[model samples]
Each structure stands twice: as structure tokens, then as C-alpha cells.
Target chain A: MHTETPFKTHFNAEQAGLESLNIKSSNITFVSVSDMLALINQYGVEQLMLGMVEYLEADFKRWLDFDKSPRFAAHSAEGVIELMPVADHQQFSFKYVNGHPKNTKIGLQTVTAFGVLSDVASGYPLMLSEMTILTALRTAATSAMMAKYLAPKQSKTLAMIGCGAQSEFQILAFKAILGVTHVRLYDIEPNATKKCFNNLQSYSKENDLNIEICHSSEEVIKEADIITTCTADKRNATILKSDMVGEGVHINAIGGDCPGKTELDAALLNRSDVFVEYEPQTRIEGDIQQLPSDSKVTEMYQVILGEKSGRTHDAQLTIFDGVGFALEDYSALRFIFELIKQNKEAQQIELLASPEDPRNLFGLTQTHSTPSA
Target chain B: MHTETPFKTHFNAEQAGLESLNIKSSNITFVSVSDMLALINQYGVEQLMLGMVEYLEADFKRWLDFDKSPRFAAHSAEGVIELMPVADHQQFSFKYVNGHPKNTKIGLQTVTAFGVLSDVASGYPLMLSEMTILTALRTAATSAMMAKYLAPKQSKTLAMIGCGAQSEFQILAFKAILGVTHVRLYDIEPNATKKCFNNLQSYSKENDLNIEICHSSEEVIKEADIITTCTADKRNATILKSDMVGEGVHINAIGGDCPGKTELDAALLNRSDVFVEYEPQTRIEGDIQQLPSDSKVTEMYQVILGEKSGRTHDAQLTIFDGVGFALEDYSALRFIFELIKQNKEAQQIELLASPEDPRNLFGLTQTHSTPSA
Candidate 1:
């Protein structure tokens, strides 16, 4: 019942015999954190964000083509670690990510991640890359892409409610993708807002963006075309109150992604037309988790697919509950895979044994034996 | 509520300040296939198998402590790619493995895998290793460990039905751990049998084992003390019939793992008392899948834990429906992790970003920028 594709019909190796276990070409590309930064810097963050948006949009437009599921999460008192897996016909991708809110207090990351992309034909990993930086880049691109569909056409200002690790990326992505020129930043801690403002000073000048630090969420909540909430707090904090939000504004709610972790008040969700990444996952992990299970919410794919309308009226309040999904990570990893193919600095590692004789795996240990120190 | 341990309490780096993004200490150890083979060769296959047997037994004895689930599988037209994850309080491990029975025809392995072991406390990967060899080692160890309890006293002969890649490892492990000095090898493909025999020739001489090649399964079925069936056919092919079997023999069924795949006949399963790894998964994927949904079976853990008896009578037929589980991979990865810690040959890769100020992930990318090629 299965027809062989050209890639699967024949062996690409020079030694096309089962006994030739010498791996001339490795299937896995290992991109470290430094290498990933180099690759992204080579392309430039603005260009990378634009490219990611295209991939994200492409995947979302054909949402039915991908297998989607709520990530399997293992929760502890300290934090949560999750495995998010998704696959299409040709390839499969998964990310191992953790959200440890208390990590920063001990000089550790509140979030860190790595991912692998494998060919569905052979099940060998094509690439393994550090997803810490990639996740930040993709998360911003997803927000901006959603805002492009939901926000008003001439949206120029972004109210960044929490200016932390992800804030600068969000600001830059908005400027690059959505033509957002002004950003009003706010954080509970003044030092955090200051750090974000100082770090973005050169980028803001280079991109011709007006970046200002606001004293409070209310100070910028009413005056912005788009509001992005990305606070790192583990609790349900109302970063944006219902009464403070203005009409015709697009809310890019990025925080409150896990259960019992929310940024928007329940009343705010009730007041806005909610759109989500995936309904089942978003209902459990997004700000919509605070709302009723039967609540009406439009899937963002429906808008991208042109099946549902986004921001029907100029005065409408639109909310994209941006709980990051596996598809976005897949898009990011796929983008990295393409970016590093021509770049020689992308390291290759022999993650699987290719023996001359497939059955003589034990013989390799004898022949290729390295004296242990 | 959490007390800090010595490892978690202090920064072991010379640069203690958050501003020092320089990472002089790395937590990740990257053990490639060659390194894995070197390590295994250093420890000797028999000793490594013996060590894995201990780890496997310990893990199985405390099986209830593990968070177990049926592997998350992504099935395609060509094959299956699966992620098997397991975690206890201290460590978490998962393997990315693929099974394509037709891969050997194109000079590729039918099964190839890699895995990661991470610290549950920090949620960072501690070790990443090629598990193609490790899986073979672990599978053989687990079988031998089970045979230690299930096989008759002083069992000497192992009848290997299918001489595939894993056949040699099984023979060696049984010889080392269970003192099975005689092996009867049989395969429909004579080349496979030849390859297995040639690979075991030197090891057989060193270990004083009597290795003989058999033409058919029936030739050695009734004479052997332990019969191991590990054919590669994807469909149900009855390699062992009930009428051909003898009394008081232990059956190690490995190949009939996936759905619609069976090596032994249904009548044989009905006549034998089956023992399985993880009852829930075995019911769906093991040889028991051919039997009734509510068939009486014993869990391997129960036998190891003394909750259930193994080989009740002298004439009873004992079947071990061995559908590989995630815990075995965990044990193998853990064993590799300990073996490579003091070995300088084991390379370490920075698979994760360990910025001094964990919150300033964007800043690290900016400062550690590599010039674009």
C-alpha cells in the first residue's frame, strides 16, 4: 500500500551495502547556543522574524495537515516541564521546555529549552538545536503575526506591559513585521523596565522606534494600538484591567500560559473577542483557562485560513491568547534547519551508529574501540 | 520548603557574578556513538551488561516510583517514530527511536536511537548519548534479568529464532549473566544467521560457548531451555507453533512488538502464562495483543518485586511478552552517565544556554554574536 518516494527508493551513501557501517554523512546537525546566536545574527533579528512569520503563517494556513496535541506536562511544586510534539507527512518535531519561576532567584533561567527535528521517513534526527533563543524569537513572531490579522491596519504603538527577557524581542519583531514604531514598557520592578529600556536603546535608534518606560500598566494601557502582556510571575496577576483597555486595541496576552497562571482578569476576557492558537490547549493553559469551558473563542487558524473574520469592526476589542504551541516551535526549528544548511559553522555530530554491517553492531565496538582514559 | 543541596547551593564557577556570562563549567556530556562504543568496549560488553542489569533491576524494583506512560508514537506510512519519557524524583530520561523494518534494504538500520538524561531539579539535560548501542545492550540486559527469575535453574541453551542485529547482544548477555553457554541460532535469511554467527565466533571462543546454526525454528524449539524469537517481519508470522513447543521452557518474545505483528501463534499464547513489561502497554502492543483483552497476565515488576511468583511449576510454559519500555532506556542512559563521568574521552556539548543572568537571554545572544559568514 506504500509507494516509495525518490528519497526513500535508494541509498544516498557511496557504500550502498548493509555491511558498510561507515557513516560518511551524518543526519544530525547540532547547533549550540553560541552557534544559534551566530546564525541568527548573520541573518539579522529583523529578517529572521520576518522569515519565521512566513513559516508560521504557512503552517497555520494548512493547520489540518499537521498533527496537534496539548503538550504532555509534568508538574512539580517548583515548576513544570513539558514535551510538545507535532508532525506532518514528511517531518516530525518536538521541544523539551521547562518553566521554573524560582530559577531566576538562584541565577538560573526561568525558562530554558532545546528541540529536535527528525525525518519521518527514517526517524533519524535531522537537527538538534538549542531552543532558548529560538523560542523567544518565535513567540514574538507569532504575536506580531496574530496582531497583523487582528490589530488595526495602521497600528503604530505597542504597550509592552512587562519588560523582561522577552520584551526587547517583542518590540523589535513588532517594528520589523507590524511596522510598530512606538513601545510603552511597564514592569512591577523598576530595574526590569530600566534594563529593557537601556538594552533596546541602540536597536530602537537603529530601527527608528520610540521606546519609553511607563510608570504603570494603566499609564500606557489606554493609549496603545496593541498591548503585549509578558510578565514572568507565576500567579494570576491582572496586568491589564478590563476598564483600562481601550476600544479597537489588540491584546497580545503572552503570560498566564500555564494553569493557575494568568495575566488578564476574567472580566477582560468577557469584554474582548478571544482568539487562540489551538482551542483545546488554549482552553486549558491560556488566559481563557480562567473562563468557562464552553466559552466561545475563535481559533486563530480560522482567521489565517480565511474561514473566520478577525477584528470585524474598528471599535472591537480583540484578544489573541498566545499560549505557545508546538507548531510554532516546529516552524522555528525548520527555519533553523534551512538557515544552517549552507553555513559551514553548523556542527554535525554522529548521534547514531552506522555500521558497515547493520547486524554487526557489536563488531563496531571492537574495530572502532577508543582506549578509555 | 526546599532545602538546597551542595550541588544546587553554590556556583562552582570562578566567575560568581551575574555579569560574567562566561560559562567555564558545562553540565551537558555529549557521548556520540563512537564514544558509547568506546565506553562499552572499555567496560567490556559482559560487564556493561551486568551493570545495566543491576540498574534495570533497581528501577524495576521501584517501578511505582516512576511516572510511566505508553510511549508517545507518531506513525507514518513508512514507519513509526516514538518518544519514550520516564522520570523519577532525581533524574528524567527519554529516547527518540525509530523503527522501519525495510530500512536495512537501503543500507540503513531498521532501528536507530538517541537519548537524553536531565536533572529533575534544574530541568537541564545532563547527558546526551547515541542510544543505538545502548538500547541493544539494555534490551539484552533486561531479558537476561528476567531470565534470572523466570528461566529454569542452570539453564544453558538459548534458541534464537531470528538472527537480526540484536541477536548477538542477546546471546552474549545471556551467556555472561545467566550462564547460557549454548545457543541455537535460526533465521529464514541465511545471511543474517551467518552474520550473527561470524560476529559471535571470537566472543564465543573467549567465553567458551557452544554456538550452532539451526535450519528451522522447529529444530531447536523443544530442545532449548530458553527460546528467544526476534524476527523483523511486520505482519503476523507464526515462527513458533504451540505443538512444536516443549514443557518448562521460557519464551522471550521480542519481535511481535507493534500492532498487527506477532511471532508466536495465538494457541501458543493461550497455553503459556505470559509475563509483560508494563501491563497497560503490553496489552496493546505485545504478543498478548493477539489474545483476549482481559487475559490473565503477570507484570515483570511484580515478579521482581516479589509480589508475584515466576515459573510456578516444572512443566509450565512461561512467556515473556517483551514490548520494550521507556524505563529500560532510562536505566541504560543512567548507566552510561555514570561510566563516562571520569573518562576524559567523553566529550561535552553545550546543548543549553547558561547565561550568567538567566533573565538576560537576549543580551547573551547580542554579546556572544559570531561574525556572519
Candidate 2:
């Protein structure tokens, strides 16, 4: 007899939960935003980011393992809500993410998200966790991961155009992973800049990095080592124009991720060595949306796989048109799940009912039942 | 002054202390199979069905009020999982559902589900509820509502193939609205037939009707006034061949709602008057998949909106080829929300976290401090 409980009967947010509930029961797991943030803080942002990068790379390597689509987006005046679903043989995941730049006005984050990880075999949800914070971590890490491949080895200074909720993470990630030392920040709202400045002041001390607050996009981007534009809103706002570009500046375009939304000018994309997380998605949602059909852009995975060069040269302008991918979510989730495992401090929330007999679904109400022969 | 809550907070099965926590907080309401059954029995199936029917009509009449897509489905060897999303001005709703026939032998229901309802403008989740029981109610109510419009004036003698979990609800719903006095059951598994027979026998007394169990699919199909094929599986099995169908039959083809999974044959679809919940989705998932691009299938909404005819004569063969719609789930959530409002017996689950200042997302974990300007 086996000493270990058959994971088949044991239902936790275990790694095996995906295979069992996905194929075996109508089981679903739920993790909310508060719990997710707690998990992130417990895990330490460095490990979380690194883990996400690794998982993202693994998924991208087996790119053929996924059943993917470009994502279905419903756009509004303030922002957009998108559904990104991708699946492989054993597992499937989809994200419900909203990008409302104006949500902060009413005391809400610009992006609020959640996701489901289900079994490809049974289609039962194995886990559900808050992706809002995870999305930020993953998005920032993904950008940093790309910059690691595409930016100069000694890159130190970073210019941030959008100093909102995402600004702190983007700067910190680059500093942690890319050896970035100095960060220059700019935002349309001075209060947003002040918030980012204060947040980064503490983060900089913890990470041992120097930071500066700038008044204009030109001031931030002028002779920058690497530039990151994470501006919000559903507009074709060109915070970074080609005219202001300096040589060898790697652009991490993070905010413009839906149709009719972009942070860079068309001329800038035409002039840079453009790379994307998912080419199909980027063509519609990334900075490439401003470019022509014949414009060339490399898929980021190719660079990661070593099939192609990243920046190619120190003097080249490398643009990582980051439009947030499902792989990033998968990586972030795997990281969080691992953190939850290592630190048993995080509360385990339950959202699925384990039926005594899965088939007698109606018996869920009945406390006692006799199974018919 | 208005005092009612403007938003509905959502909780998952795991958070509500259910079996699984594989869901994120957002526009998703994850009801474990157990939660759904609990809601159904507590609210009583009759109240739920009637409530859903009322919402269905309201939604259907304001048909253009939704951001509707036919549906997007992904099929695998074990089964199929589908994403059905719809949005109105005020709210948006989507359901994640799957069908796997082999699940029962391994200990699982053939279908399992969870859904999300959100505010379209705010991009925030209003409510999340277990929809498995609600799905059963909505599915049956949708069929009954369609029968009210499409079936002959006096519809009785409903023959149900595959008398599993769904058949009980289907029979009861038809009995309630369509005055379906006669029901004949058939399933490959005699246990399923016995279960359905026993369940409906008890139900018929309350509804004032009669229920019968038959061994052969063809015998029941031949005499049935309304033939309902609710078989569970992936293979393209023909529960009723064209030869078995009678002239005046209203066929509710519920089982065939996936790409590789179907029940009624191509010949049956061609000979009968086919009506679908959504034409584009039905063309791919319904028995109509066996038909051609030019296949003339009528939208059920058209008949309801008076743009198309239902049954012109008693002898006309009618088929309500329902593959479940987002609008139906929309109606289900709406019905449940209304039910919880009217009846104090409804249980309230906590799914979302309240942070005083959303920007201090990190402060959610620490002692509260006023956000600095």
C-alpha cells in the first residue's frame, strides 16, 4: 500500500491540482488580490521576477505546446478589458485584466485582474489567483528579462515616462536584474511623479540604487541609457518621439497594449530594432500598431532561444514592445504557487467544493447520501 | 437617497471555503459544483427557473443591449471547454464550462462551470456565484422558453435520451412552462435512466405530471412530442437517426455543443427545422456542423423578436439546437442576484478585499497610513 495520500483524493493548491481537478472533478481554486500581494511580498520580488523569467522562457521554448489566440479585448474610453486564453496539453490559463487609467481617480489601481489555471484534459479549474499584482510583477520582470537580452551589458541609467503604480516595479526590476543604477522619472500628473519618487526613494535605499525625478519626457529621455514608457490611457499618445531619441537607448514600451493605444511615434518604431513578446498580439496592441505592414520586428523568444541576436550592437536602439503575454502570467503564477508552498504563512483560500461523489452533483446539497448501485 | 449597494462583491468556492481555489478575483464568479447545488435546493429549482425565464425574455427583448460573440470553443481528446462572454452597458458576464463524457467513470460530472459578472464601465466584478446548478436551471429554462415560442401550442410527451443530471431539470422545466405532462427517458447506462426516473417521479407529483422510463432511444424518439437528446460524450453518436424522428417532434439537442462532439446526425439536421441559440456558434458546435456554410438555420431570437416563424403547422419537425449561450449565463447571474435580493435566505459570500486606498496596495498588508499627496 502507498504511504502517501493519493494526490488524486488530496485537493490543495498543489502542482498536481491542475491534472486532477482539470480532468477529474468540477473543482476550482480561488485566490484574491490581497492574498496574491501577500504571497509576492513573502516570496521576495527578486525570486518572483527571476522565477517568472525562467517559466516564461520554458513556455516560450515549447511555444508549440500552447493553444493560443491573439486575445479578445473590449475597449472603452478610459481603458480596455482583455481576455487572454492559452492552453497546452496538461494545463490552460486565461487572464481577465482591465486597463483603466482613470480608476485611480476613484481610488482604484489602473489594472485589476484574476486568472484561471485549468486542466486541458477535463477543463476543471485547478487554481485561481489574483493576477493584478502578479501582472505588474510579471510585466515589469518580462520587460527587464527582455532588456537583459537586448540592452547593453553596462546599462546603468533608465528614463521612465509614466510614473504611476507600475513605475516603481519597472524601475526596481531593472535595477535588480539589469544592474541599473540611476532612474529618471516623468509623468503627466506631478502627484503621480511625487508618489513614484517617494515609493522609489524607499525602494532605492533597500536595493541600493540612485534615482532622480525629471520634469519632462525630453528631460528624462535625453541621453538615457534605457527608456521605459508605461503611460496609461486608451490613446495613441506618443510620449517618446523619434526626434528625441538618443543612440543605443533600449525602449521598454509597457503601457500601450490594445488596439488604438501606443506610447511611441510611428517613426520611432520604424527606426528601432523592434522586438515583441508575441508578434501577432504586438502587431495589434504594441507600439508596432503605429508601424506599417512591411516593418520588421523579431519575436522575443527567438532572441531568448539564441536563434538571433538581441541588440546586435551597443549603438543600436533596442525596443521591447511589451504588450503583456499569457506566458508571463503562467510564469508569475508558478512563482507565486511555489512561494505559497515554501512559506506556509499565506492563508489557503478555498472556492471549490469537494463532492463526496462528483457525479451525483445534486447531492451537494444533501449532507448525507446513499449512492445507488 | 439610494442605499442599496451599487456593486456586488464576489467570492470563489475556495474563499467561500469550498474544495478548490484555482480562480482569481475579477469578473469571475466561481461556484463549485457543491455551491451551485446548494443554491438550487435552497432557492428551489422552480423559483430559479421562472426567475431566469423572466430575465431571458428581458435580455432577449433588449437583444442589442449586449456585446455578443457567438462563442469561442477549444476541443481536446477528453472533452471541450468553452468561453462564453457577453457585455451590456452596465455589466459584463462570461462562463467557463466544459463537457467530458469519460469523467463519470473516473469520478466527475460530465459538465462543470463557473462564471463572472462585472461592471462594464468600471471594469470591476459585481458578483460571482456558483453557476453549475444555475446553469442546469438556465439551460432547462432556456429550452422551455424557446419551446414556448417555437414548439406547437400544446406541447406534451417529452422523450429524453441520456437521463443523467441534466434530464431531471429539463423534464421539470418543461413540465412547469410548456405543460409537458408526459416524459419518457432513455440512456445507455440503466443507472442513469433509473436515477432520472426516480428523480422526476418525485418531481412530477409536485408539478402535477407523469414520468416514464423506457429502454430504447428509438422507441422514445418515435412517440415523443418533444425529443430531448442530452447525452454526454465527445464522439458523434446519433441518439436519434432521421428515421426514428416523427413529424410533429420538437427536438432539444443539448448534448452536441463541441467541435468533435455531437449527437444528432447530419441527416437529422438537414430534414428538420433547425433553430439555434446563436447561429455562428451553432454552425460550429451544434449538429448543424454536419451541414454546409449556406445552411439556413434560424436564430431563436429572430423567432422571439417576430422576425422569423416558429412552427407553422403541427406536423412540422422543430429542433431547438441549444449549445448554451452567454446571454443565458447573463440571465442566470441576473436571476440569482435578484433571488438573493428578494429572499433573505440567500447566502452571501466574501470574494473581494477592501483596501482604503487602492494605490497603497502594499499598505494593505501594513498598518494604515494616510496616502501622502
Candidate 3:
């Protein structure tokens, strides 16, 4: 059902005549923002997130197979732009993401991202996708996935401390993944809380979820079984204090994802067991940056592999200091790539130049000249 | 005359009603392979290379202002994929490129690339372009730009070894930028040499340039004032020995760009005064990789900035061991971004998601719900 695009058509026409050469097409599948939303609409968001969590769990189980490195970041006065790349034996993926705390002040997203998935053998990109929405989905899915192993058993209350762009997704993921029945929302700006409460109205009604709006962090965390702190301040602000959090609570701290940005009080971290996605990256960008370099933390991959313990007792406080890892993006991209393959409406773009004769790249620019046989 | 696409239209309609918020559009300009070819056809290939050389030289002159790093590479048994990222104060650009020497056996190009350029202020991408063709152009422009500084006075003959995809572009860049009047070509495969010769026929005839084909590296290097080695072998087979290269000849060695790949003999690198684009990168990937790590080599930026000398005497052999740098890609991306801005046929793709209220990213996914302002 794919359209006859130039990149595919040219290569296919040449391939039909020269099947012995085993030519590969250079067309790249592109999933725009609209396309992503349509896919979410086609397959429910809950189903997509469940699929993504499966992929994330599967990838994390084989974590040793990946070639992982810390992201390459370019820091500026305004914000940071980063490239996060990871690879397995068969596929390679990378995400280009930017974070500017002041972007919302000017009516822009605080974070935006795009990514590519490629074949390892041919080294040609198989898919290029917009990751703004996908990133939100994956981040929330990751937090919820970790919560499956770290959150208190039979937990039903989720406290969302920052009602920003990521607030609703976090609530949905918890509700869908962990059977969360109640959401307590708080934000510094009342309008933000009102906006998030309004956005979740239909989802809460349809899913039998009870939602409450609170005025302060202390009020929000009163009966929260899981607390998610995602404030967008670029400094070390204590969104949660030592005495504010109770035992048997899980904290997913995601917003403090840069060098100088952090959220939890140091005393709070000292009193709790912390888990992170990738230790090397979390040390520099996660909420645990306030802690010493040798601070005790467990990597979630180890927990998933049954190599390490997770949430040992009912009274234990667990914090997931997630700065987001490249492997999650790889899983997300791979999941979406499979979804788009079955989607007849998927769009393909001519991102690479493929000539009939690979050696005759210059011949592509020659409109009037043909390749010499 | 841009089209009224969904991304631009939605953002623009929202932006007009909320101009006080200073909303920016999320549309990314896309230059497909057809667009790149059209651009080369619109502006002559020689002229584009000349313009690109000016940018390469200007960016190299202000080298310290840039944030430079070695490419992040993921190597496999067959090939490697790399991400080269570099940024200055105002803009950031990164190229995603792959090199697979065995790709041609299956009818794929040995190398293919694409890149993105973004604004540092907003951390939003401004353009996305197909860069397989662009990389070839920039590599040639960078080589010729360096030759302008190190080639001997009144240099005319350019002996090109390994006439593959990059051969004609190098010939054109040298002819346009350095005023080379004659070219001698040699390749291990006769068809490659024949293809390059046929490709350059019209340009050579129109530019008053004489071109000849030689069977051996030694025969091609005779009477040569500048030699460029761009063979595609991924091993340490020497394309040029010390005895083959004559005095007063500058060599632009570009093919040996990985750890195990070396095109020039060790004795040849030892005999020449090596100049490199970036010393740390070249020490691992360029022809200078064959030399000792402590071997003295001048960075081309220092020479361009007048901090060091270049081509001191007629008999001095100067080799520009170029592994290609991110700065050259940055300059080429910047140059093309400007060009596409003026070209009306430039395509725009929806590579980002933009909601009216930045904090209400979830509102974009909810098709039936209206924002409760």
C-alpha cells in the first residue's frame, strides 16, 4: 500500500532489471506528529504503552548486548541539546533531544525530540520519527515499568507534583499499568493544575479513576502510594523534604535531568533506596546528583534481571532517579517501526540518495546523462 | 511561497491570536535528494564548491569558537555508523553517516549521510537535508580549501588515485578553487576510472582543463603537483608509496579514515610535513595514523590563523591528512540552509509537535477535547 515515491521507485525499477545485484531501497519511513497521534488513536494509547513496556522490559533483560555510552551534550546558557545513541547486534538507534526550561515562557515546548533507527548490516536508516510525543509516552512507560517492581503492592494512589506537559502522561501510565485508581495533582501555578485536571477528566471518568487537585506538595503527598516529581526548575530546589515523604512510597523523579538541576532534598535521598536507568548518566543529571559520587544506587536493569533486590519491605522508600536512557528510545523506536510496517498510511521520505550503480553517485546529479553500461 | 501544511497552519493560527507569547513555528525545511540535485543544477557544481570552500575556510579560521569532539562511532564486523556533532554559540549541527565497504557488493553506496541544523536559542531544528551528496561536496571543498594554503605556487596537475564516488567532485573542487589545469586518474578497477573520466568530460572541455587516465599509481603520480588518495579499502594496503610521490607535491589523503585503514605507506607519512583538520581525530583515522602518536603535525586552523607556517619551500612535501571534521559539516549545513531559504521549491516536513499551549502537550493527542482556557 506504500506510495510510489522517487527513492523507492527508482531503486525498484533498477532492481527489477538487475535482481542479481540484490539492490536495497534507500527510502526511509517517516512518522510525523500527526501520524503518531493517528497511530495512538488507531491502537489505544494504553495498548501502545503496554507494547512499549514489553519492548523496554525485553531490551533491559538483554542489557549486556547493547553498546551503551553517555549522551553527547552541547550545553548553552539557555539549555542543552543532546544526542543519545545505542546499538545492538542487528539495529542501531539514536535520539536528538533538546531541553530549554524557559521555552514554555515563549510558548514553545520545554522539550522536543526526533530519532532514527537503522540496519546494522547495510548501515542505512530504516525509519525516521518525531519523538516529542513518543518520548513522553516512553518516559511515562519507563517510570510505570520501574514502579511495577518498586511500588508498594496493591498501590492505588499516584501523586503528580508538577502539572506541566508531562503530568497527564505520567498519570495515564500509572493508571493503565499499575491499576492506579486515584490521582493527587499539585503545581506551583493553579492554572497548570486546572489544565491537567481538565485534560484527565474524560480518561478518569472512563477508567473509573478518582482525581483530586491539591494546593501544595505536602497536601498532594498526604496519601500518595507513588509520588512523581517532575518540576522544570533548572536549579537544585527541594520539591520533597525528608519528613514530607512517608514509608512504602515510590518516587519517580524525572525533571531534574541536567548537570545543575535537581529536585529531592539530600536528606530524603540518604533515607531512601534509589534506583536509576543508567548509573553513569544519572550521576551527572538525575536528582541523585545532590548525593555523593559513591552514593548507593541500583540500576533497574539489574533489578529486572533478578541480579539485585527491589523494594525489599513494605516500609522501604523507593526513588527512581531517571534521566532517560538511550536504550529506552531504541526500544520505543523499534516498537513504532514495527507498528508502521503494518500501517498502510505510513509515509516514506527520500532521505538517502540511491543510484542504480552505487558507485555512480555523481550520475544522480546528471539529469541528461545515463549510466554507462 | 510555502504550502499551508498542518504543522505551520496550526501553529500560525495559534500564534496570530497569541502574538504576545512570541510563539515560534515547528516546521523543518527538508532538502531531499531531488532538491539537492536541483540546487546543483541551478547553481553550477563548480560555483557551489567555490562557495562551500569559502565557508570551510571562514569556519576553520575561527576554530576556537566552536565546540568540537571526535565522532561517536558504533562499529560492526561489516562497517560503522557515526554521529558527528559540533556547535558554536548560535547554531548546532550533526551528521549521521555510515561507511560500509562491502555495501556495493549488494548494490548499496559505500557511504550515505543526512544531517540536521538547529538554532541554539530555542534548541529547535531549522533544517534537515539529505547529506550523502552534501558530504561528498564538503569533503572535496575542505580538501581544496586546504590545498589553497599548502599546494605549491603555480600548481597545475592533480593526480587522483581511486576514482570512485568522490573523484569527480574532488576534480571539480580542485579545478574551481585551485585553478588546476590538468588531471591524471588511476583506480584498481578500470570501470571506476572510466566512469570518472566520462563524468568529467563536459566540465573539463568547458573549463579548458585536460584530463587523462593512467593504469598505475606510479604512472599517475608522474609530474603531479597535488595528489589526492580516496580509495575505498578498509585495510592498510598502501595506495601510494614513498617512492611514487615526487617533490613539491601536496597529498590530500582522505581514504584512510578508520583505525585499521591506512592508504599511505609509513615512510611516505614520515617524509612529509603532515597538516591535519583536527589532530586528535587524524591521529586515529587519517594517513597520519600510520605514524607515531608523538609525531609533530600542524593543525590546519593554526596555519590558517597565521600561528604556524605552511608550504615553506618549493621542495617541501605537505600532506593534509584529512579525516573530515564536524566543523566542515556545520559550515556546509549552514551554507545550504541559507540557500534553501531563498529557493522557493524547498520542502518543509513536520518533524516536531507543537501545541498552542506548551504546557498542554496532551491536548494535541486528544482529538475530541478542546483546551479549557
For each candidate in the order shown, give its overall lDDT on alpha carbons: 0.82, 0.71, 0.86
lDDT of 3 by residue, A1-373 (tens): 0112112112121122212212276568888888888877776667777778877888898899899999999999999999999998778999999999999988889999999998887898888999999999999999999999999998989999999999898988897788889999999999999999999898889779999999999999988999999999889899999988889999998988889999999999999999999999999999888888999999999999999999899999999998999999998998887777666657777888899889999988787422111
Which ranges in model 3 have alpha carbons more than 4 Å from their true place? A1-23, A368-373, B1-23, B368-373
Q: What is the per-residue lDDT of model 3 for residues B1-373, given as tens digits with 9 covering 90 to 100?
A: 0112111112121222212212267568888887888878877677777777666777887799889999999999899999999997778999999999999998899999999998887788888899999999999989998988899988899999999999999998898888889999999999999999998898779779999999999899889999999999999989988887778999999899988998999999899999998888888888887777999899999999889999999999999998989999998987887677666656777888899999899998888322111
What lDDT does model 3 reach? Answer: 0.86
TM-score of each: 0.92, 0.89, 0.93
Candidate closest to the true structure, highest lDDT:
3
DockQ scores for all predicted structures: 0.46, 0.28, 0.40
Docking class for model 1 is acceptable
| lDDT for residue A338 in candidate 3, whole number 0-100 | 71
A-chain TM-score in candidate 3?
0.92
Task: Please give the distance, in angstroms, between residue A343's alpha carbon in candidate 1 and its true position after superposition.
Answer: 1.2
How would the docking of model 3 be graded?
Answer: acceptable
**What clash pairs does model 1 have?**
A19-A356, A19-A357, A20-A356, A21-A354, A21-A355, A21-A356
lDDT, residue A249, candidate 1: 91
Residue-level lDDT tens digits of model 2 in B307-370: 8898889889888888888999987886565444433433333344334555544344343322
